[model samples]
Target: EAAVTQSPRNKVTVTGGNVTLSCRQTNSHNYMYWYRQDTGHGLRLIHYSYGAGNLQIGDVPDGYKATRTTQEDFFLLLELASPSQTSLYFCASSDGDNQDTQYFGPGTRLLVL
Candidate 1:
């Protein structure tokens, strides 16, 4: 089955810090995305790409960046992050089709203090 998951299920950091969270997929898919989940809010897309070496900014791209290093690996980068950036991050992947269903990861919990 096609699946996507993230690492470091929880994390804590201070203001103005750098954090890197990773995601991986086993579906051999060509589309990947990173989104943040917050209370009383819909999932906000941060970044996504069709394949490795390609990235497209989404709705909430500020203070966050992402990279698709390989077909099965993607990473999110938060540099000089702020408390506002603290939220649950989820990774997802699709089969590179417009109507393809997306598989979501468990998510990574981040806290900035």
Candidate 2:
């Protein structure tokens, strides 16, 4: 199995709060991703990185920012959080050897009240 983990398994914040979700992959994967899961939208990619310091904007790039500091570490930042952004966030990693295979962390549940 893939070794990916996220911090603050659950979070609660008010509107306009600042939130940060952290992830780390121990598989030495070259590619890492951040995604959000909602009721309607099953899962939407928020951002990704091919390597350290390389940021690639995903389909949903607004109100979210991310950074990959090392091969094993990636972080998602929500500077000005909102209620609509409350959802289950996930972090995934891929070795890049296979285009179809990826490993996902459990998930981080966030609530904006």
Candidate 3:
């Protein structure tokens, strides 16, 4: 079974700090995505990639950056972070475009002061 996992399930950060949330998958999926879940906004796309070397800008890519170094690993980078960015961030992956089911990680909760 394909599984996506995230680290530091909980996080606390001060304003103007940098935070990195890690995500890894064992299914060797071809597509990976980063999204943030807010109270009323629901799941909003941040960034995604088709493969390790390719990155595609998503709806809310601002204030966030992402990179995929390998097929099994992908990372989300938050620089000069703000409280507005504080939310539950989830990482998901699919076997391919034909696969509609998105396996999501537990998620990382970021709290900014």
Which candidate leads in lDDT?
2
**Tens-digit lDDT track for model 3 on 1-113?**
67999987999999999999999999979999999999889999999988887899999998998999999888999898999999999999997867478999999999999
lDDT tens digits, residue span 1-113, model 2: 78999998999999999999999999889999999999878999999999999999999989999999999999999999999899999999998776558899999999999
Which one wins on TM-score? 1
TM-score of 1: 0.97
Candidate 2 at residue 37, lDDT? 95
Task: Sort every candidate by lDDT, greatest first.
Answer: 2, 1, 3
Q: Which candidate do you rate higher for TM-score, 1 or 2?
A: 1
User: Candidate 3: global Cα-lDDT?
Assistant: 0.92
Each candidate's lDDT (Cα)?
A: 0.93, 0.94, 0.92
| Candidate 2 Cα lDDT to native | 0.94
Mind giving the per-residue lDDT tens digits that candidate 1 earns over 1-113? Answer: 68887998998999999999999999899999999999888799999999999999999999988999999999999998799988999999999878999999999999999
Pairs that collide in candidate 1 are none
User: Cα-based RMSD of the predictions, in order?
Assistant: 0.8, 1.0, 0.9
Candidate 3 accuracy as TM-score: 0.96
Of candidate 1, the 10-residue stretch with the lowest lDDT total is 1-10
